[model samples]
Target: MSMNGREKITNKKRLKPAKIVWQVIVYLLLITGAIVMLIPFFWMLSTSLKESFQVFSFPPKWIPDPIKWDNYVLTFNSLPFGKWLVNTVIITASTIVGTLLSCTIVAYGFARFRARGRNVLFLVMLATMMLPSAVTMIPVFYLFKSLGWINTFYPLIVPAFFGNAFFIFLLRQFYMSIPTELEDAAKIDGLGTVGILWRIIVPLTMPALTTVAIFQFNGAWNDFMGPLLYLSKPDLYTLALGINFFKSQNDVQWNYLMAASLVTMLPSLILFFVGQKYFIEGISLSGGIKG
Candidate 1:
């Protein structure tokens, strides 16, 4: 072999071990992170299956010896879990529908339409996201109270119809990423602006819409403060609020609480897994797009 060939081979040999070592280190770090993330869930599951006494036992049992599966049954019987589930479903479904309808229109306009102050208006809208929720909470609550929306689902579901800044920004960026040629083609086919948006833009931006739906669903489902502030009647309580039934001044049902929490989290977990592909694609498109 030539001297140059011999030198290249030596360099490759030296680099191979270094690359392997880096790969091993990466894999080890990933595994460690996976374990750390999963430990709490595993503990929740273990506690849900164990007798109350086994939960705080020394050395911490990773598995239940007797496996008290009745914790779930008892939890349901002891609380209004079914009613809470229905209320949550209603709020989440309504919020997703409202968010999609309102955000899509607002984003489509921001993405496609031209006006003198459009850019200025868009900047103002984005600025609202920087304001803390706490800053607006009291005023918003007072406004809802003035409208007699307090102690009702209206306060929770109605605000969603107004659209959110983050979802609008996400959908707008993704919409901007779509080729303008598609809109021109639709227009040449005699489609109006709204028709073009529905037929061309919407179909092309399904991933972004799915991302919005998933986010709104997760938000409404996990919202404790909104439900607590707006909903006073027990019948109107969401699963997030209903979970507190396990708490009392005298005693807290740890096993039942864990079981209920796991059950409540299942829907969000399933939703993310089901829409994960579109969610990731939407995020990539939204981030990659520019004015």
Candidate 2:
């Protein structure tokens, strides 16, 4: 055989082994990552289905022998689970709507307007995101108290209508990424700023808006501290606060608590999966802007 033909044969043999090695490596990494990410959820499900004793077993049982399907029933029966779920749904939905409307308006102003001190104000708003919620909790509580909003859903829902700094910043970044030429063209066609924003920018930014809605929904739904602090009445308690009420210093129901948690997480999970396309697009747009 010629030297060139021999070299070609050797290269082919080397390439086959390298391809196989890379394929094996990829599969190994994927399996390892899958196991790591799924372990917590698997544990949660196992505990939810297991008898109370099996939940805290030293050896850690992956599967329950006789699943206690009754735990879910017991959890709902023990508390006003239905009512709590309803309250959470109402608050979450209201918060999402309010946040989106308020944040989009604020973000549009920051992204499109050229008012004096606009950049400075935007920077100040961005700086507020760095301030911990814990730091402002007491002040906000006091402010709401003065307004007699305590023990009502107002504290949770009303603030959302005022806009959240972080969400506003996220949306502003996305808004800034939208080309200015479109707005200018609309202006030339007798569309005012508000008209252009409503007819053009908002429709174009639906993905980012949906992303903001999803995040706000999850945040409001999962919020424990704010609801716990604001709502003193059991009737107004959100799902998070309701779950806390299930626990006592003397005794606790691990199975029921886990079941409740699993239930509470379902809506956010469903929303995320449903809005994943818009969420991904929003994230991409967020990365494309400044502040």
Off by over 4 Å in 2: 1-20, 279-291
- Each candidate: what lDDT? 0.89, 0.86
Measured by lDDT, the strongest candidate is 1
lDDT of 1: 0.89
Q: Looking at candidate 1, what is the lDDT of residue 225? A: 93
Candidate 1 lDDT over residue span 62-138, tens digit each:
98999998999998998899999999999999999999999999999999899899999999999999999999999
* The 10-residue segment with the lowest total lDDT in model 1: 281-290
lDDT of 2 by residue, 46-90 (tens): 888888888888898888889899999998998899999999999
